[model samples]
Target: TKIKNEFPVFKNKVDGKKLIYFDNACTVLKPKSVIEAMNNYYQNLGVCSGDRSSHLLSWRVQELVEQAREKVREFINASSTKEIIWTKNTTEGINLIASSFPFKKPRDEVVLTLLEHHSNLLPFYEQGKRRGFKIRIIVPNKDGSLDLNLFKKIITDKTALVAVTHLSNVTGLIYPIKKIISLAHQKGAKVLVDDAQYIATHREDVQKNQMDFMVFSGHKIGGPTGIGVLYGRESLLNNLFSYNVGGGTVQSVKIHGNNIKVQYLPPPAGFEAGIQDYAGIIGLKAAVNFLEKQNQEEIADYIEKLSHYAFEQLKKIPEIKFLADYQNQIPATLISFYFSDKKVSLYDFNLFLNHELKDYFVAVRCGHHCAQPLHQFFNTSISMRASFFIYNSTKEIDILIQALKDFFNRKK
Candidate 1:
């Protein structure tokens, strides 16, 4: 596809081999549109404090942030643009909710899953430590798939929130999110989906799924790093107090005695604490526009087909073992296998391969892909990962396979 050509990285050669980058799960390559959009922001209007200025250039930058919020609102089918809050990244978004949002003392349980990334897990841990709340964890199966039965048992009347990933980055397994949300709601617990790995890749419509909240990273969706989205239900957000307040986010500030009585602005504004990333926000909106034009479904399907083919081809290597044989289902890029035997670490063998197979590209990974808790359920040691995206094709996978087999033969 011309998509591969659009990325300059593919055209660049390494050791006489065209660079074969299969690490889409880590962070996707931004397209020309996202690049051009950010460049234009700097070239045309590189103004600081967009909201504070009355100049037209400053107003343009201000509109960019708002437009990005609106675009994300549309992306997730949020009820109102005001419900979409800008964050540094998904980790920050999760932290924002944990640190800022107020919860009743009696209803303080935070439910997370074994498949959660560290970004989604640690904030809850810290929050639990501070709030003196019990953090309940849902265990996944040996193959890294979640057990919804366990989830039903955990979320109770005392549960304040249920935060889970929409897809497993380790196993490429899609969770039963709609059912999870329904169960959480029945228990009067709010649901927050960490869509960092799935958002633009999975085509998630939060409103259609009746999702109460959602979060995702911009870098994963072909935008710049350091930008994220926090989508909250309009009603739910209005009731919750802002964790951070500054600049135009507050309507009026008043000092009464030693305490402060501030008339906080509504969400979107109220949630945007401190100075915003105007250029990054503009790039994020451009990224959304890029996804919209290509059609999210088309991009998803194309990437899925490539990932499925990679899975099939990679399974042919005798030395490799799969965590789960889920080529027919799952929407994630690709995740499977490690280089070591029972006695050895996958990191060691994969490192040898990466060094020895310098003549060709064999995209592989080791270590828990940040889902360390889930790793206990499936992998005894870290597994190798080679993920694909819309820009990837069969030719690239073929190169990776040959390089891998050659290294294995040399080692033996």
Candidate 2:
């Protein structure tokens, strides 16, 4: 409740407007606990080389790091802490594994879906282009849901990996991950879930689902930027090869005139190559604490109700088309729409929303939203999206509705 006061962004008005943040689909506002944790990390506990050093201060910082990792492990229910690998963000986590996977076999296939974020797509696509592995793209349902039946057809004995999103960033559709994982495991395929947009918002029981890997971003969930998690199974972690090498990964190295051998540490440390963002990680832990303090079920319900109201109100305008069907129970905080006039470019609509009403809401994104493929299925030229968070209220939705009405009424 007092979170808005801590985030400095809310303190200032834009073009004489009070900022209403609805752009949570892209990133969320951080709470005071997160901010103070970050501040304290540098303001007092700042240090270098968290684990390699022996000094009290350095070890203390390392303790903080481990504590943060434990928080993530507990939050996601990881069987073993060793399985969690820290990355810069969800993008790096996906790419690191995708790029570094040891292609020790003659036949290996990687499966992706159209519902994937680009972070999940391009990495595998690049791997396919470079390494001779077969890449298959599973199609989404007409309603933007993932088609599991389609997955059963493409997965084969040769399939090595399956990477998909737990939730669609654009469509607001949730995928059947447990079923997807079951289907993949039957074919000896490991799955990597892009929880970048899905995690921290939903209730996830990773242990029950038996998911092989899950990755998510910190900034998206109100933690500081430049930090994320890569959760892998213990068996998979043991066999995993690190993509990066630096201070933390190396135990020793032997150099020869023409050959070199570097001894690498095990999974978690081996994968975290360079210097880490200590403060950011600390802040991430606080962010997780703050979220845990709230009731997840209630939060999820609030978002859905707000989303439903926004959708119904938007539908009242005949000159507009919404991107999502109101019937689906995808989280409602985000509602995307378009103007019906042929003369109106999406850019114009976005510009109006961003510039004309910059103060009313702070979180809005315009265009393909890095989800171009999704727009094609919806048959939209472009979209103006308003996202919601715990801070948003129904009154704001009404304000948005009236704004839309005024725009169309004046134009006509």
Candidate 3:
């Protein structure tokens, strides 16, 4: 597909082998359009944004930034640009909500699942420690799916927030977010979806989903790093306190006697303090545009087929043990598993692929994948992950399978 060629990295050779990146769950390779957009921003309108200056160059930069914000709003089907806030990544977005969301009393509860990345898990835990709120955790079923009934039972009147991943980065299992959001709203609780994995392949409409807030990282969606999006309900955002305060976030500052008064801007501006990552934001917009042209549904289907092909091929290996049944899951974009014979650790297998399989240039991830609790539940410290994206193909899956087969044969 031309889409593969759009990523210039694919043209380059690593160790004289064509790069076969299966780590989309970690970060995606940027398309030429995204790279060019970032370069253009640096070359042309490299100036401060917002009301900091009235110069033409500054205004142009501010216009580009606002245009990017509007594009993000449209991408996620947010109600307004005011609801879209710029963040460093999904981690910062979750932290913004964790630190600023109004929790009135000590007994206020924040619920999460076992499938969360550390970015979604730790901020709330730290906030709970400081704010004296109770944190309720819901463990997944044996098959790595959330028990909806158990989720309903755990969230009650005291629940102030429910944060969960839209899709599991490790298992590629999709959560019933619409149902979960409905239940949370019924209990007068807000919902935050970590779309770090989901956004790359699927479409997210915050208004349609009735999500209070949604977060995703730009790098995971073929954009540059250090840029992310936070989509909040306009009313909820206005009610929340500013996460960071500085120059661009304020509407006015006045000195009265010995005291100084600061009137912060509304919603997104108040949340985004100081200078922003203008180049990265532009790159993100370009990435989103590229994905939109490809059609999200088609991308999802292509990646799913690739993942299923990989799963079936790997299943032939008697020593392999899958963490979850991939065939029954919703469109597996990634798969995680460990070797049952324990002849080698996950890292050892990863090193074999990177070093011994240098000619094939297969790249995958290995570790806890920032969900140590989930790994603990599975009774393992680490596992290997092979994630897929639209640019990947069944041919690459075949290459991967052949490499694994060769490894096993040699070991035997």
TM-score-wise, the better of 1 and 3 is: 3
lDDT of each residue in 116-146, candidate 1, tens digit only: 8899899989987886777888887665667
lDDT of 3: 0.88
TM-score of each: 0.93, 0.94, 0.97
Colliding residue pairs in candidate 2: 20-361, 20-362, 22-387, 23-363
What local lDDT score does residue 94 receive in model 2, on the 0 to 100 scale?
Answer: 93
Ranking the candidates on lDDT from highest down gives: 3, 2, 1
Q: Between 1 and 3, whose lDDT is larger?
A: 3
Q: What lDDT does candidate 3 reach at residue 194?
A: 96
Candidate 2 error regions (>4 Å): 1-8, 103-107, 324-333, 357-362
Candidate 3: where is the Cα deviation over 4 Å?
Answer: 325-327
What RMSD does model 1 have? 2.2
lDDT of each: 0.79, 0.80, 0.88
User: 248 in model 2: Cα distance from truth in Å?
Assistant: 0.9
lDDT of 2 at 172: 64
- Model 1, residue 348: what's the lDDT? 60
lDDT of 2 by residue, 1-412 (tens): 3646757777877777787777788888888789889999888878964577778889889999999999999988998789788999999999887887755564488998877777888888897788777788887766566667888999888889999999777776667899999999998888999987777567676798898889999988889889999998877876766687888898888989979999898889889887789998898999888888876677778887897788778878899876655354554357777877757666665556657764464346777877676687777757888877777788878877877776676677
